[model samples]
Target: MSRPRLLLVYPATHKLGWVKRFQLPSLALKQVAAATPTDWEIVLVDEVHEDVPFDGNFDLVGITAMTHQAARAYEISDRFRSQGKTVVLGGIHPTVLPEEAGRHADAVVIGEAEPVWAGLLGDFLAGKLQPVYRAAIPDGGQLSIPWGRRDIFSGKQYLTTQTLQASRGCPYDCPFCITTNYFGKSFRYREPEDVLAELATFSGKLTVFLDDNILGDAARAKPILAGMRGMGLKWGGQANLRFAEDPEAVRLLADSGCIGIFVGIESMAGEHANHPKTGSRYSQAELIKRIRDTGVVVEASMIFGFDDHDEGVFERTVRFLEECKPSLPTFHILTPYPGTALFDQFDGEGRLLHKDWSRYDHGQVVFKPKLMTPEQLYQGWQQARWEAYRWPKIIDRVMQSPGKPVHLLYNLLRRGGISRPQ
Candidate 1:
């Protein structure tokens, strides 16, 4: 007569130390927890911070995996299933390759869980659970889902537990990204009132929005930003850089308690995915300056290792970061994740080094470069990160931001990562 217990797991790839505090707890798991029926008792086990409770009593185990965590996820899922726990797999990796996931799971949920989760739970309780529960991607501009269950994250440390998504999906079908293919090709938003209402309950000042592009749609995003004007929260989120082209949007963003923003410059080659084909009259250097001038710290994300990139690409990227002087510059080696167009192109050409999902973390080189060897691609990535985080470069970046102290703190934190050998 006890309530059925559900365990949600976030599988860890490796041990994390001090940096664990800054990692965002799984927003995907939080969403999954939100969709469970009220009769179910929920528990979370983030393997990064705690051991999986294999000895604990639980009726259902839900494991979410990104591509990088897929190997770890399978290990955990296989262990739980061997012990007779009903394991289910979901999230991006499972959705991308459900058949691979099904070998270890009692069932798999494809696509977003919000629409299909309760039904899966009902069927499980009814003893009629199917092999897969697939939810359709939302194509509309509006989104409505329950507020995530923060109570489930009760004892966890994170950058902030105040993370929530104001929107889902992106209009841009950037070849390197999986967001558009799986989540839909539109800026689907929660009603502004719903998003604000959830924010009102947050007990902390630091929050993060987990959207691909929180400001992708100007009209829809404005209401949420306007409603947040007096909320007294300090927040950060990722969005496209082109959003800065509008002066008022930048002002409205800064006014809305946004302390930092991450924008993807994507590549050093002229193929920056987020920019329009017509191109803006203002250079990226100018747009970056506009956002930084608003006292909102801008973290420009750049990727290296396009087919055209040669040995000199690293120097060019470091120079670009110098001119832009973003509060932080995050460099990534290009990763062709499965389900992306880039992945198809690389796989078709037999360029993939291996199907080992664990190495697809963007920090490692998993494919042969068209112009350079894999070693060259990887060393260039490491050198660019080290080059950008050198104290002189860090100081140059920090001094440019209006929020000097915050910028300096983050730069030092980044420098530590860049200094650590991969």
Candidate 2:
């Protein structure tokens, strides 16, 4: 009998050209590949780099996608299923709307796939494949997942293939976020030793932790940072700004070869300040400066189009970034993604423009703004983006950055993103 083969796909909306080299390979697919029994051969096709081998003789086809990739993903699924291959669809989009996805797949993994992947494959081999496999939402507890299979990404040119997740889930449930819905309401960490051991296998110094917040649980994060102190790995990851409040934690983070960190500022509106995550505007700037002072680049992100935001939001946000002077400022239009409170509220109010998932990406405005037109929100986003990347502003930021070249590279790359004219 021929050995079983699995083809995992990372669908892309469009070709990325040289930009694909800087992107990270899909960690979600890697984890799925890891959970596959050793008996099966796994092949991966990242649509951004190469075309999917639709005619490949594979026993099982697995495709993962985020909200914006849903259209392309569904198209790919339909094509594969038409060829008589058993298909599975899972990811943020499908996990939120499994019924819609079920219409296109032989099976849908509702949550983390590791819990049911083996069983699904078994059922398939036994010719008893089911339509749905839902894993329970992980709440408070340690998270144990197979170290994602890095070999599956072999021969692929990514910025760094040494990416892993040390933890999952977030404690905070922001109205605009779906994290709590899809990944429970608490931080579930892995053993520090396991994370360190995985790092030991990484050959190079370039590593990235694809966690919701690497420092969400400072207690759990410290141990991993301590172990990585001597690893000599220059890494970057996202974390809540609150982490810098503890001086010792910042020291440990700096010593752990963390070259940069991305933190969410969300919005500059006063309503946002009341939240513990944002705190007061005065202190948020202080915290960002504290992290940047440690020779670590801090990429502070801001989203426009909160209910409290008005026509002046774009200028006000640009002013705040001027004061904070973070190493970089990332501006986004607030996106009401499915499976979030924001989406529900928008839909109930009939504020959503349409159910076109492709335009739901943060780069585009997909809802009517409470205080401004959708076109205004989009134009403001574009204007603020150009304002932040202006020659003088970029120079000011790069001057304070520890790694000047890296800072400039990031600035250029972010600026290169094409913006549709108003």
Provide the lowest-lDDT 10-residue window in model 1.
269-278
Q: Write the per-residue lDDT of candidate 1 for residues 275-334, one digit (tens) a residue.
A: 342166778889889999988989888888888888888898999889878889998889
Prediction-by-prediction clash tally: 0, 0
lDDT of 2 by residue, 189-260 (tens): 999999999999987558999998999999999999999998889899999998888989999999999988
In candidate 2, which residue pairs clash? Answer: none
Task: Report every candidate's CA lDDT.
Answer: 0.89, 0.89
Where does candidate 2 have its weakest 10-residue lDDT segment? 273-282
lDDT of 2 at 166: 95
Model 2: lDDT equals: 0.89
The reply for model 1, stretches above 4 Å from the true place, is 269-278, 420-422
Cα-based lDDT at residue 284, candidate 1: 85
